[model samples]
Target: MIFAIVGPSGAGKDTLIRGALAARPDLRLVRRVITRPTESGGEDFDGVTPEEFARRQSLGHFALTWEAHGLSYGIPRDQITGPGDVIFNGSRAALPEAAQVFPGLRAILVTAPDILLAVRLAARGRETAQDIRSRLSRASFEMPAGIAFRTVINDASPEIGIARLLAALQPVRA
Candidate 1:
């Protein structure tokens, strides 16, 4: 199964995914292809430019790619070949196309109140105020409707929030 976890910037997405991986050794995670420069201590990735990304996409290098915040994000189909279930925390904007390519796909859209989101962004010390504001202005995340998402976790209480997400993976009772 493919599980795509997405939320706005500063929504504790990378943190939650890392924590979940530590807790659940059985889970598999996919690193994304990005145009953004690699930052210290951030998730690992190969940097591709818009032109290179477009060239590669034409060659079918990506299972999916999307434009957002003046950057390109991609998920290569090659990585989705293994049997283990996959987990990725990325842009919701990447979902529409990504889901269609991978069978058994699901989404987990993480979100918090706007005020809380800003606070989290500030705490990260990664983005300038202007950059953060531009990201927030994208308004890319909202409750995903009609998608077979496992669950939506509020980051207010992260420990319990992750537990709820893990629980949602289990078979539901009638």
Candidate 2:
């Protein structure tokens, strides 16, 4: 099955997904495609130039794609086809398109109040304040009121947020 972990930046999306993977080895998380360079100590997609990404997209190499922070991001279709529980960080606006590809995909919206999110983003030191603000404004995380296997969790510490997300997803097991 497919699961998406979505939220504003600094909402602990990566931490939650990592913890869930650790707790559930059966989960095979999808890797994303990115145009930005990966940070020295963070997990991210291998960077590819925009031209290369465009070529691949034209070749139908991505399941879903979006642009953020002046870079292009994509989730490869092959990654989504794998077995076991799957988790991905993605845009909520793209959920419907993803659902078209994987009918049973579920979305978990990880959200926090703006002030906290701002602090968290600042602490990361990876983005300028203006960039963070722009991302926050442009990023989408709204899911329709009612949808199966979909839920929301408030932003807290990584472990805390992840635990909440885990709790939210546990009941949907087949």
Candidate 3:
């Protein structure tokens, strides 16, 4: 099963994913390829130039690709094959295409309140004030229909959020 972790910025998706990984070593985390600089840290991902990203995408290297926030994100075709339970940070808008590619895809929506989101985003220091506002504005993006999903409200401590996420993932464990 492929678990697509979807949420708004600053929802602590990376934190929860790291905790879950430590707890369950059997689960595989897909390292996504994004067109953002590696130094612009958030989650651990392979950052590449737009030209490089386009080159790879054109070579039939990506199983899934989507554009968001003026950047291109791709999930390499090799990463999802022969996996145990796979997980990757994914876009909400790309869920439909993801489902079409990986039929048994399960979406894990991590979320927090708007106030917490604003604070978290600011603390990260990855985006400008205008960019942060732009992200916050889309916090309420609705989930598309016809996808199996579980929601984990990351509104508390890291420990609590990880516990909730693990609980949500229990049923889907291989």
lDDT of each: 0.73, 0.76, 0.93
Model 2 whole-model lDDT (C-alpha atoms): 0.76
> TM-score per candidate, in order?
0.84, 0.86, 0.96
lDDT of 3 by residue, 56-138 (tens): 99999999999999999999999988747898999999999999999888899999999999999999988899999999999
* Candidate 3 backbone collisions, by pair: none
lDDT of 3: 0.93
lDDT of 2 by residue, 109-148 (tens): 8877777778878888888979889767754545744454
Runs off by more than 4 Å, candidate 1: 138-140, 143-145, 172-174
Strongest candidate by lDDT? 3
Candidate 3: regions farther than 4 A off? 172-174
Residue range 56-101, candidate 1, lDDT tens digits: 8899988877777777888887877787677886667666666667
| Candidate 1 displacement at residue 39 in angstroms | 2.9
**Candidate 2 segments exceeding 4 Å error:** 138-141, 144-149
- Backbone clashes in candidate 3 total 0
Best by TM-score: 3
- For model 1, the local distance difference test gives 0.73
Error of 3 at 5 (Å): 0.5
